[model samples]
Target: MRVTPQPVRRQVEERLREAIITSRFMPGEHLSDRMLGDVFGVSRGVIREAVRLLEAEGLIKVVPNRGPFVAFLSAAEATQVYEVRAVLEALAGQGFAERASTEEIAELREVFEELAATRPGTDRMVLLNLKRRFYGVMLRGCRNAYVARMLDQLLNRNSQLRATTLSDPKRLPQTIAEIRRIVEAIERRDPGAAWAACREHVHQAAQVALRILNQQARDEAAQGLEVALD
Candidate 1:
């Protein structure tokens, strides 16, 4: 059986999405359709489609007379994202613990091991991709379509902040430990433990990420003040 090729439109969209998530495009920076088309070697129409998709996903925003720009997230806004994601992911964890087959659990463990092995110096995109792979297994095995969909959306928004969050030397080890607890809980087939671990991991990440975001915000504000006064 021949596998169907992925659509070019989706391909362009995914590339653009990854670029934004990895901070190749800084937050609040203008996005020119012609520039993106040239960069991606795609047509303006394809770039527009990709931009529209990102805009719908909340990763990009289109303003009247301003075209498109990367969406900027404040720490307070990111907290809302983390809060919603934590609850949904905890539910997914509980479902996975109760419902995943042995094979699925093994697959999840394999992904977890790979994620655990990633060094602190790993490329941000590579680390985030591995994390997404781990969650892809868990979300599928959980067998809850709605929860999976909701959590995936939130994760997309969270990825930019998370990549920045991981740049802090203190976060990587703690992140790995929190994930270890999640894996162990799932292995024990304890829904409560799985939920607890998942929740704790998400909240811990939120705290670390928020600290980074707040500092960046303050720094930007100070720079803006200095520029205005000059």
Candidate 2:
């Protein structure tokens, strides 16, 4: 009854979390424990444990008698998330602007370079990982454990939306430009400017994501209508 390699459960949890956040496992899709166990090369027990982790993160839900399904974002939930992120990210920017050292600025620049080099149309999951690295520079620069903890959940969800937005060729330039402006404000040690820039960035991105999510819902609804008509 041993789950081979033991640590495979943790690996499976990470993989599933990535898949869910990147939209690879779309909302409302029920995850079959047996199929997932096979996919991860682990036991059903391991898959259950992995799902439990995601459920706790609010990225998945386990319904009684219905198994586990990927979590769907309500419009209200999405708006709240962006609102909270704006305040928290502004605080992070302020903290970073006030005390970010030259070394930290250079580190952030390096991450920005990495982000720029990443070509468009890359796998969403891979782009998310890179985006996390870019965000890591800002979070570390802020140097506040509480802010970091508050942002963890929001950041995970943001990365998913960011990836989807950036996937569109039309949005890529604006995304990069907005991020660059924030970086410039931070480098100048202008906390007010940094906060303003960061807030605008988050707000614009949120609008784009909301549009994308709404469009997806419409597409799904249309498909369901077609099925019904058939």
Q: Count of backbone clashes for each model?
A: 0, 0
What's model 1's lDDT at 14? 94
Model 2 residue 45 lDDT?
92
What pairs collide in candidate 2? none
Give me the overall lDDT of model 1: 0.89
At residue 30, what lDDT does model 1 achieve?
A: 93
RMSD of 1: 1.6
Off by over 4 Å in 2: 1-9, 117-126, 227-230
Q: What is the C-alpha lDDT of each candidate?
A: 0.89, 0.81
Candidates in order, TM-scores: namely 0.93, 0.85
Error of 1 at 137 (Å): 1.0
